[model samples]
Each structure stands twice: as C-alpha cells, then as structure tokens.
Target: MTAATAPTGLGEAHTVYLDHLADADEYAATDLAIGLLDAGVPAERVLLDLVAPAQAEVGERWARNEWSVAQEHAATHISEQVVAAVSAHARPDPTNGRVVVACMDGEWHALPPRLVAEVLRLRGWQVTFLGASVPAAHLVSYLHRYDADAVALACALPMRLPYAHQMIEACRRSDVPVVVGGRGFGADGRWARRLGVAWAPDAPSAAELIADERALRRVPPGQLAHLADDEYASLVRRRSELIDGALAELRERVPAARAYTAAQLDATVSDLGHIVDFLAAAVYVDDASMFTEFVQWLVEILGSRGVPVGAIALPLEHFGAVLRDFPRAARALALGRAALPGVAR
Candidate 1:
C-alpha cells in the first residue's frame, strides 16, 4: 500500500471519513484511522474522537460482554494500524516538545494512550504512543530518555488501580507531571486525586488539561479539587435531559384491574420488563443494568397501586429519543424481571 492518496478537499475528506466509519464493523478500526489520516483531519482530532473514542466504545461493550474477544481483537489490530500511520505523519517541529502516553501494567487498554498520543501530536507536540501494558520501570526509563513534557497513562479497570498508582508514583518521584484517565475511573474521581495525579475524564478534556503544563502545574491542590468537581457536574448535566425525560414517561402507564392467567401474566410481565429496560437505557449510557433495576422497582410499585396500567410506562416513554435506544434497557429489564415471581405486575 503506497498509502491511499490523501482525500483532496474538505468535502472529500468528510466523505472518506464517514465511508470509513460506515461499515466500520466490517474493517479493523485501524483502517478507519488510516482513512482519517489520509483524509487529512489532523492526526490529533482523529485520535481524540475517531480512534480513541471508537476503541473506548469497543472496550465498554466488551466489558458488558456485548462484544466478543474476536471483535475486540479486530478493533485493537485496526488501532495499531492507525497508530503506525499517524507516526509516519510525525516530523520534528520547532513549535512544541514531546508528550509520552502509555498504559500501566495490568492495563491492557492501549487505545486510550494511543488516542492521547495522537491528540498531542496533532496539536504540534512530539508524541510516542507506547502500546499496552507497560511497566512502571519501563515508563520511568522512557520518561527520562525522551525528557517528556508530560506523562499520560490509561488505567481502565479497578484491577489496574495498583499498577496505575505505581506508575504515577514513578512519575512523581521524577518530579514529572502525570495525567490519568479512562471510563473505569467513572464518577469517583477522588481516587485519581488521592493518587496525587491529574485526571482527564475523556480525550478532549485530556488535551485541554495538558495544553499548558506550567499553568496546570502551578495550580494548588485545593484549586484542582474545584476543577474536578466542575468536571463531574458537567457529566451529570450532560445526561440530565435523558434522565429527566425517562422519569416523566414512567409516570404515565397504569396497570390493568382485571386478573390474568399465568400465561397472560408472563407475557404482560415480559412486556412491562421491556418497557422498563427501554426507559432505563434512555436515561443512562452503558449503564443498562442500573437503569433496569430502578425501573423494575418502579414497575412493581406502580403495579401494586390498583392502577389500570404500569404507571412507569408513560413517564419512561417520554424519554424516547428513538426506538432503537430502548432495546438494551428492555433486554436488561426482561432478564431482571424474569427471575422474580409473585411480584405485582
């Protein structure tokens, strides 16, 4: 491959990027990463949104067992391709120094670091995207070898927490500023803080966090807590619309008065479960289980009210952003409710 010729214009670039992402399930995401580079979207933006976000989404699905190992492997292989292509695009620039990104040992999720590398590189920083599962000693060695402006690590699971702490400790010993992030961190950001490291909730935020190292370094610990609070609040606000809408819909449907046979009860219970699942999903992302639990309890309460319909239905329905969004929640609801018997329907 002499390199797919770079897409000629912005419109052409849009076409190529979308086309690459279209049957993305069919090709390794790495191919799409190359396609983005070839389309000239800047190595950084592609890494931030397209490459890293795609990989994170895949990892999330895998955690939920929604994606098989093969699918995850395919995605990772494509990510390697993208990283290679982006590296080829890198050239020494007088403008900015280097930033190094790596995954802590026990942290096999390389895509986050890769995406962060691309983001820094795109912003004119030199970047070295070390692949997954790097040990603290190795990272410390690299940090000194490269004289990195900042060191970033992706810690995506609770199991990786010890390793992450070690890596951050290594950087701190060397007096190097470190940044950590991943969905695994979730809303409990205090751990990152307690570890005495800066935390980026997502790729874009990471880029911003590192854009001016001295300023970030200058901030006192007390000030940093304020920033963390703001970040968490923003995430809640971002999802508030969906959560509120779902609760509204759940308030509408009333349970029926007539008693039903076992078969009817089973079907009705299943349907109600579906409705709960659907509504739960509408309010949360990648959190179908929690949503299902909350909705099912709501359903049981509504069913006992002597109401003609499950009161939770209409309130949850109001959350309908689209029909497809409801399936995961519905599936979750069905699975949960299926276990219970003698619950008021």
Candidate 2:
C-alpha cells in the first residue's frame, strides 16, 4: 500500500511515527513531526500525540529485545531534533503570563520540558525555554532575570532525582513557583509538593495548570490537588482493576512464593498506583510521557533485575494483553519468582 493510502488516526499515525522512531529514521520522523505541527497539532499535543508515543514504542521494543541501545539512542536523537524544531516556533503572547521551562542539571532529556513549554506557549503564556541540563544557579538567575510568572522542570530519568529536587528547592527559595513534569518525577513528586511548588505530570496538563487560578496565586496546600486531579486523577481512580487483580492472581498461584516482603509489595503497589496517576495525567492532559516512562522503567528495571516484565502487572502487560492476550507478564513473573527465591512475597 502507498504511504498516502495508509489509514490515519491517532492510533495508526502513532504506529507509523513509532516505527520511524524505533528505526531511527531521523528524516522520516522529522517530516512526520513537521507534518504533525503543520496539522495544527499543538506542540504539547504533538509530544503527547506523537513524540511520547514514539518514545514509548522505542522503549517497548528495547525491552522486548527487539531494538538495540544504539537504535534507542538514534530514535531519541531524531525525536529531540523534531521536538526542538517545534519548540523553536513556540511564541508566547506578549501580554500573557510567563513560564520558564527547563531541565534540571544533568537531566538532558529535553522533550518533556520542551513539550510543557510549547503547550503553555500555545495557551498564550510566554515561555522561556532554558533547554537541557541547566544548573540551579543559572535557573534561579534566569527566574529573576525574566521575572518569570512560573517555572516548569521536565525530568526524564530517575538518576537525576536529587538534582531535580534541589532545583525545585532553589526555585522556591527564590520565591518562584515551579511546575515539574517528566517520567522520572515518579517517587519525587511529593517532594515537589512539600517544597510548595506546582507539579504537572505531562505537558498538556501543565498548560491546564497554568490556566488554573492556583498557578496565578500563592501556592496552596491543595495546589498538588490539581497535579493529581487534572494530571493523574483518572489513572489513580481505575488502576486497581489492573494492578490489584494481577497481584492477587500472582499471589494465589504460588502461595509459598511470597519471599518478597510486604513492605516491598506495598511499595510496588504504590508505584502501580502512581503509574495509574501518571496515566490519568497523560490521558486527560495529552501528555504521554508519564505512561511511556512508567512502562519503560518497568521494562528496563525488570530486565536489569533479571525479572521478566510478564511476571509483573505493569501497564505494558495490560497493553500487551490487549494486543495478544499473551499473558507475557504472568508467565514471566511466575518464572522469575521460581528462579529468585527471595522475591516472591
């Protein structure tokens, strides 16, 4: 079939974009991104609609041993180029509020922060793109220099957790309200709230957040509520059906396999809950990174730990099940539990 004859929708188009991303077809991905941008797909939605899904697919392929690290790196490079191009055109309204979008020091993944900036800019808020790996001192200076209305940080790795928190604290010390997004902001989200800053799990929700009254006023105790309500509320509300049921079934299969501690299981459950939260944020706000990151992390971490993702109830399993009902996770988990004697409970 000719490319022009191919079907189109968020789903079909998304698959093509992902294939190009995984293949590191930089020219193709860039053109797809440009076409998406020309289609009036808001830059934020493009990230949510195109880039994030593309990243997720690349990640999934890597997890399944389908794509190599070089392939993943190539895909990321292509995505960065395209997303950065779109971000370059993000012009904010002159009289609107201002937001500073940055990546914390050592967090070079600029896609999420860039995505947030685009959405806010599309919403008529002035955005200053600080690019990637920004130092805290420089960000503070920029906040004062620009008299920024809000600060947004995008993080894409767990390795930069400490730096991300430090930057948020620094912003708060400067009396600058901040909003944080990215897939890696998982366990550290509460820290952002505790520092009296705003948090958006994704770009689109970050736009809605900038629109909220809370984004304008002093940060409140409930400011985090919007991060949950608008960003991740849906996934949190409905994840029990997937995670809880899966865990319960696993425990039933191997009653003696409960070598893993309750504390650990509880944390896993909590992480799954947060995954739901992130998914909700992505769904409602048009930010796919959260969902992508969650699944990606699960796959990578499990693989590193010699755990098969099919042994877990992660969303990938949910997605895989939808695609093939393969029970990849259940089988993997069962095998992993059998091999790792201490990880069962």
Candidate 3:
C-alpha cells in the first residue's frame, strides 16, 4: 500500500507487516518495514506502533489456537528479523547512555524486551540486549562488569514474579535500581512496587525513565521477607519426588501420554516439573492466583497441542493429594484443578 493511497498511516503498515508475519515471509516483512520508512514513517513509529501491534496479534493467534507452536516461533523469529532489518537503517545515537535489558530467569518471552532495546537505541540509548532466560547470578555479574544508567527487566508470566523479585533485590543490593516491564508484573506494575523497584509499562516509558537525570535510589528488600513457611522450601527439596509421582499417575491414566515417544515424554516431564516449581513459588508468595492463572494459560497451550484440558485435572488432583498437608499448596492445586473444564470450583 502506497503512503498517500493508504486508508490510514501506521495502521496500514501494521496490516501489511502482519500479513507477511503470518505467512512467515521474512523478506516481505522486512520490505514492508522499509516501505513504511520510505513513506516517511518514523523508525520508532514503525518499531513500536506497527511491529508491536503485529507481534501482539501473533501471540493472540497462538493463544486462540489458530497457530501451532512452530508457527508461533517462526512468526516471532521473523518479527525479530524485521526489527533487525529496520534497525540497520536507523541513524546512530550520540547522546544516549548505556542501559542493560534482560528477561527474568524462566521468562522465555524475549521479543518484548528486544523491541524495547531497539526502540531505546532509536531513541538514542546505548542498549545491551541480553536475550531471554537470564539467570539472576549472571545478570548481577554482568552489572558488575558494565556501568549502566539503568537496567530493564522483562517478565511475561505471573509465575515468574518470584524470580523477578530476586533479581530486583539483587540489583538493589548493588545500589542499581531496576526498571521492570511485561505482563508478569501486572498491568500497572503493582508487583514491581511491592518489591520496591521502578516500573515502566512500555519501551518509551522505560527509555524516558532511563533518560531522566533524577537519581533512582530504591531501598533493597529484607531477605526472605516474602516467604512465610518452610513449606515452599520443603516442596522444592521434594520437587523430584513430586514430578515423578505426578508423571507416574499421568502415565497410568493418560494412554496417549503412555504411548508417547521418549522425546515427548521428556517434554511432558519437564512441563510437570515447571508446574511444580511454579506451585512452589506461588506458595512462597502466598498467592493462589499465580498458580491458577498459569494453569489456565497452560490449558490453552496443551489444547493447541491437541491435548484435552481435562487431562490436566488429573495432575492437579494428584498434586492436591500429595501436598494435602500444606494449606497453600492444597489451595493452589485445588484452584488450578477447578479452573479446568468441567471441574468443580
């Protein structure tokens, strides 16, 4: 679509890029981005307004089961490539200071932060985009070696708040305030405030925060303050036992699971382990909703894989039986199980 003939400005660009992304056509996607630039669209507008909306829709398509796992990955990869292609044409920034961007450990969603990195660079910030699943120790170590004006942490899942908290406190201990984004911290970053750190809702806001000359001196949180009981710690110690028990029960109950190839079984086992870890984290934070929400999302993911949502109920029920004595664990498992289709609340 030509700039003048297009019905709207950035809106049309979003449509064009989305069409190519859905088809996993990298060159078309890159060409569309360049076309927008030729049409006089600002680089930041193309990155945030056009590409961001398209990427959000790609995620929604996956959530609605309109795209397979591989399709989602391919689309996201193409989007990443498109961002790089657009950045290649961006003018160099001379005034922006160094800033580090990273995702919380266990947060596999890197696209959002990567978008922020490029946007910040376009806005004249020297960005070090540390891709997905960065461990807190590694991040802390990196901070020691590099001097950054601010660090931006991305967390896309509520199940990751515990680790996000850890990373925030770690940064605080070193007197480096953190700027947090992504859905995991809630819409307004309520969790980030609870952990006593700065929260930026998006890339522009984050860049604005980083650019502000005012000092950011957030107080570090006390150690182990969020945890109440040894139950979470105990559960973590028994994590292997829990996953093994749940896997064995699923193998007996799910014929499809029993007939799976070794690789598939390994994936299933890993999924179960993640559930256990998230449950333990929920108990540690005294929130059942985190575990319950993860289950609801996991149900959709499994549904995309052709697995019945109700099959997940068995494992939740099994977890309830195994952790019956722990009040938080029991409630978390019950809420998760109840969230499944046809399960009682």
Best by TM-score: 3
Per-residue lDDT of candidate 3, residues 1-345 (tens digit)? 454544347776677777788888898788778887876888888888988888899999988889877988999999889889888987666476788999999899999999999988988888899999999999989989998778889998776777888888787676676788998876877666666677889888988887763634543443356466688778889999999999989988877778999998888898888799889877766778878888988988888878877667877888899899999899999888878886776
For model 2, the local distance difference test gives 0.63
Per-candidate TM vs. native? 0.53, 0.60, 0.89
lDDT for model 1 comes to 0.57
Candidate 3 global TM-score: 0.89
- Candidate 1 positional error at 133, Å: 1.6
lDDT of model 3, residue 132: 99
- Candidate 2 ranges with C-alpha deviation above 4 Å: 1-3, 37-44, 87-95, 213-345
TM-score of 1: 0.53
lDDT of each: 0.57, 0.63, 0.82
TM-score for candidate 2, please give it: 0.60
Q: Give the least accurate 10-residue stretch of model 2, judged by summed lDDT.
A: 322-331
Candidate 3 ranges beyond 4 A from true positions: 1-8, 213-228, 254-256
Indicate whether candidate 1 or candidate 2 has the larger TM-score.
2
Q: Score candidate 3 by lDDT.
A: 0.82
Error of 3 at 41 (Å): 1.6
Winner of 1 and 3 under lDDT: 3
Native-to-model Cα distance after best TM-score fit, residue 161 in candidate 3, in Å? 3.0
